[model samples]
Target: MNFDNNKLIKIIKFNLCFIITFIPSIMYLHLVEGGQTATELWDSFINLDFYSYYKMIFFLTASFFLLITFLKYVDLNGIKKTNYYLPAAVYSILAVLSSFRAEYKEIVIKGFPDRYENIFVLLGYLLLVVVAVNIVDNKKSFKLILKALFISAFILAIHGILQFYNYDLLATEFGRKLITPDGLDFFVDRLSFVGKKVIYSTMYNPNYVGSYTSMVGILALGLYSSSQKKNKLFISGILSTLLFSFLIGSRSRAGFMGFIAGTVIILYMQRQFLKKHWIRIFVIFTVFTLVFITMNARNLDEIFSDVLFPRTEQEKYLEGEILPPITEVSSEAGKLKLKTTEAEFEIIMASDQIEFLNKQPINVYNSKDEVKEIIFKGKQYLHHSFQINEKENYLIWNYGAKSAQFYYQDGQILMAGMHNNLYPLKKVESIGFKGYERLGSSRAYIWSRTLPLLKDTIFIGHGPDTYAMYFPQDDVIGKLKFFSNPEIIVDKPHNLYLQVAVNTGIISLLALLYLWGNYIFSSFVLYKNSDLSSWKNRLGIALMGAVTAYLVAGFFNDSVISVAPVFWIILGLGISLTILAKGN
Candidate 1:
């Protein structure tokens, strides 16, 4: 006991590391890249920052080096050290096997810079976690983690509020400007959403606004659980806005699921104290939900159907009507048939309101109110990013009247006709709704074609970052049915498990089993182990629920293997767990 008791908290509370990690951590929620895609997940190589990657890389290596230094400084019994070592060893072995299985195995080992640059990022992260764990030895460190959470979350909450208000009071005069990995000026277009100019923070996607907000809300709930009121007003207020910000980031299923699940976990964790104040909690939730709906009600159905529904239903949506290939000779014929059918559709407006509204451009962003009034409030409230270009019919002006209304009408019609005949004869019936008529969602088809490649490499599997090399080049996507938009460059397996299996073979399965096994096993321990701290049990429940939600959401998403933040968050939790387990 060389260190003072108070000195431990001060030392464990590493401020700079927390700040840097917080900025990038919010980027995990940047699921939508300029609203073009649902998720902003990037491939491992593409994930590194364009200019900042080097800076981050330097710090990443430094963090690991610091861990090595710490291990020698403190006499860690072999048990704690070995626990940290197991994950690293597993990760390293898998990495090695994958490199050998990679299309560019030679580059991974000897020269190494050419193909396997991204795998190094994974290695760097593992090392960072291992080092961070050494700093986290006991309950006091856990309390320090809470302090880090409170400060970082408070900052993030304020940032999220400004985002909803379409005001960027932080650094730049102008609001957020998001550039692609290739530096295209695509994000400039989304100036108005629901009539308000959309603003972004260091957190990339507005959808990510939900992630940061939800995280802070969970942490605030933890604080509230302890009945600490030093920052009660600030914490509750932040949680309130976070709830509202989610609605503003419409169409993000992950955001909705993550927030709701996070909230449920919090209420449960805080039940012992919060039971009497259930009415207040309910009121808080209602106000939050109402604000979100007011800002984005058209998205309500989607939130209900897609985000809130159980996992099995979503998987069914993904598996949708897979029709056999169409070998038609004439593209013109297909287009003509589609056009004529659409024209002759008598325009069966999905609902009576569409027809009854006298067809005044039929715009509705999200509301059941007078729609005209909603249109006005929407202008004042939502679309904080861009204004309605009334001159251009394509602009979104109202919460329930602008693009959202159009999306809803179109979405419902598309859904109603889910099994509708594609052509005069027949072709892919199980098309993804909201997927444009011209091309059934390209993601599913791309995955379908890649299935065979996965089968061939089922053993050791293909290497990480090798999907581009392994993906079928001569398929319809490459040769025949090329639509525009090359940015959806799916060079790797979209399915998470499949991607893992393809790269690491049965090891991928084993890794998954281990990850899930630990989660399940730990959850049981939390429930059964009476010695555990209340905070640990609550954190465990939250993590378990959050991870479960993520897995279910991932079943329909391409999030797992890429250098996405969600995966990093999972890794962060794993690291935290490893630390939590030590000295227990």
Candidate 2:
């Protein structure tokens, strides 16, 4: 019985480590039919999307397996108590309660389409922390996990380098087939992800690629700094340089900032060690600098400009001579009119169809007594409701909570109000970062809007994975100023703190903050007391630096499933390492 239990524990530990190391690179694509009808603003045919579905399944299955095995091990033995439990418990309870009261129960359970960090996924994250702390009982296990992570980062960095040079492995036919399931050749052919200059590697978005490498790249440096052997040092230095080069290719300011933060932490923590080995640091920096310059030889100015001004400057909306779509109604018939400084035309809206002034009839409307909605490709994406006045006729088109109002004026259709877009302009509140609204790719705009929501979430939040449902999606001015698109959905706050505060309540945020604070404090105390020569102590510092980098970057990047699991697992390992160091 003991032998069987021991073997099971080893298997569970291996599975946990394997999943954590490889979760970022999981890109198996399968169709998710019947997407959310109300919330999805994009194509409705898919749900899991490309980067999200497989990662969720992989995490869920592995987490469940590790959790069940851990539970069995606990039943045979017993669980150890730690100071980390209180805050974890508080945060977990609040998250569960928030999910229970979520308005979109399905989303809270399964998560939003294209971004699945649902309640189950949240639980899985916590399970990672627990299992990581328990399963990693020795230095060998800990070193093994770090080595796997380093190798994964090395491979991904190489892929990112290839992508930067316009040689994306995934853009090839074989690459598409490699990511897609068998017999999905048609789906693979339909994929249009080729011809991208930026490098996102396997992490979906360039921003995410930045976030991921920021953590692991810094950790790679930590590994290099701590190693004594020449061979290990050489290998670690190469890994660090490669990873940092990948970070540069991502062009993610948040990522660069995160890398800086981690570097600062490492310097502060390993000041003595670094004083003796300053040459190594210089050599690694020189290598990365040369690589960065070589990779961006033609775009050096553009890269620097991006860092100086992170947000893309919004173009001023000049009142164009072109007229937007407008509806005009009389008792006799309804007409969709278009008038510009150059030309004017009208389309007659019949009871069930639209007829051009002198051309073919377009079967574009569904109506019994009056025209209701426009139909395209046998589907109605928006519900159109019209109101007529003595002056003009206006159309209010709604998709879920979002609505766009257009009014006919001077024979031209003019936009009146775009809900959720520029909500700050419509309503007044003491907004933060007033002058710097464009900072961090207009993260200030999102934060200014998101800050107002915290007052309502002091106790209980809307629910897990329901940030999109609650956020003001109709801020037209905000969208126009930040994104130049009045119709885009502001799905995430782009700030992890705001995401947690809005989705899981301020109380939960506080609990999580407490958990972070506890971990940092405990780790610091352990690090200060212990000798840095031991690989275990050096690992503790590396974990601290990596986790700190991730947290610092969280200010500009929200915790997505692609990168959040890595952070949580590293955090758990850090916690366990600290505890083990203190025990010694």
Candidate 3:
């Protein structure tokens, strides 16, 4: 009776920890900003209320668990003996120090202090590692963790599919609205067309959801292979299918690439297992691929036509099309009649400011507007307007001789003619896939502007999360022809490696890289040494493959609080598995 009771208590403890770990992903709760509100808190820091809440829960739960663990075990012997404890501790300390440096530097230089919440977040992750290692000490606990993860992912996958169809039953029937207290709303319409869809599921972005599903899906594959029971295999297969479908629906190029890379790694590592389950694998691949292609045919078509083979600005301008200038402006009608433009332009005059239409203007450039300098009684008058989907407003000031300076609201300036070759109005001509455009969506231009700025901050970095403040201040970036708009915030480096270098400094970045490198090395060693027939060995390989996929995806996307927790959890699991294998 005592043994049974103890077992039940253990199960309950494991279940509580498991549920707490994932509560943040699904629970969208926040402090209702009543009368007592800190306006400075809202303005000064990057709004991460959801993330902050999650970390707080994680910290409190972990602290409670640790206290219980110490009372029961009387020592931190288990964690102290683990190979990862020292490295993780060192990294956490570095991260906290980096945050301090960033906060101090930002306050001194930018006149605004950075939120050092990242320090607590990092510490929470470290505590998670310790807790995970302690709780998931055996195969039963490990399998339970996987089961919880699979179940969570399965629900999210279903949600994504329903959302893609515009049938968000949870939102409609249950009134399940995501709370965005900081005004940082993740509900974005990423589809180019009205009916087309790219599902974000419960995550903030499609890229995040894609990476998440990909990781979980790959882990499911490992679990499926390792299971001896027919029931376990059947369940895992269902999870894999659901996750893969969600990943495809995300339509994130980075996620797609990462999935492909992860799949290759899994296949390579599990080559022996494939010999027996080839038929099942083949069927899964075929069915999932067909479904993805069928659902996303229109999106694929748009990618080929709009992104890959759309006519360039030069090509469009050479077609002899010219946008007529505003000949007559009426303040009363809130409209401006251009000379010969295809569409009508609306002029809005408010707060002593005159601006063009709010939507994508009929013509991005007007050749007929020859008056470079608009002077009312010898005082230089500036015209300011914003483009569709643009973050920054631009001011048009006359330089000299039909030339104008476009000053981004953030102070970055671009000098160009009234009818500059780069700013020509062009209709997107679908010429089919002719390979990817040379520029690849202005990322190349942004990278070019960013690379030169990395020279000075190779040591201590510009401070944690301070990249956006300093990156725009670069002279070359400020003068860049394409991205001269200060309204456009370059918050992340786009590349995870570059972002790490910018935020955490080179020392911390190297330490992080070393940690990952060692994990990969150890996981590979364990897989190589273990029996091919064993499920445990295969599971380790699968985790290695998932990490590889995540690393590849990181090349294009920056880490965010929503997704980083899952990645850290996965890493912790891998470390636990490694330590267990060594003990055996």
lDDT winner: 2
Write one digit per residue (lDDT tens) for candidate 2, span 1-584.
98988898788878877786778888877676643632454335555366877898888888888888888988987877788878888888989998888777777877777678888888888888888888786898887788778778888889888888878888788898888777776665444435666777777777888789899888888878877889989998889988888988888777877898899888878888878988888888889789778766336444344346543222111222112222221212356543322223355444333334653223434444344343223122222223223222444443333344444444443444333222222333436766446566667878888888889888888888788776666565455444545567777888899999999999999998998878877877777555678988888888888988888888888888888888888988998988888788
| 113-185: candidate 3 lDDT, tens digit per residue | 2112245555655666666666566777777777677777777788787777877644452423444423433
Model 2 stretches with alpha carbons more than 4 Å out: 34-45, 182-193, 297-406, 409-430
How many residue pairs collide in each prediction?
33, 11, 1
Which residue ranges in model 3 land beyond 4 Å of their true spot? 1-24, 27-80, 104-117, 176-196, 225-227, 297-459, 473-486
lDDT of each: 0.42, 0.72, 0.54
Residue 116's lDDT in candidate 1? 28
Which order, best to worst by TM-score?
A: 2, 3, 1
TM-score of each: 0.59, 0.80, 0.68
Instruction: Choose 2 or 3, whichever is better by TM-score.
Output: 2
Model 1 residue 157 CA deviation in Å: 4.2
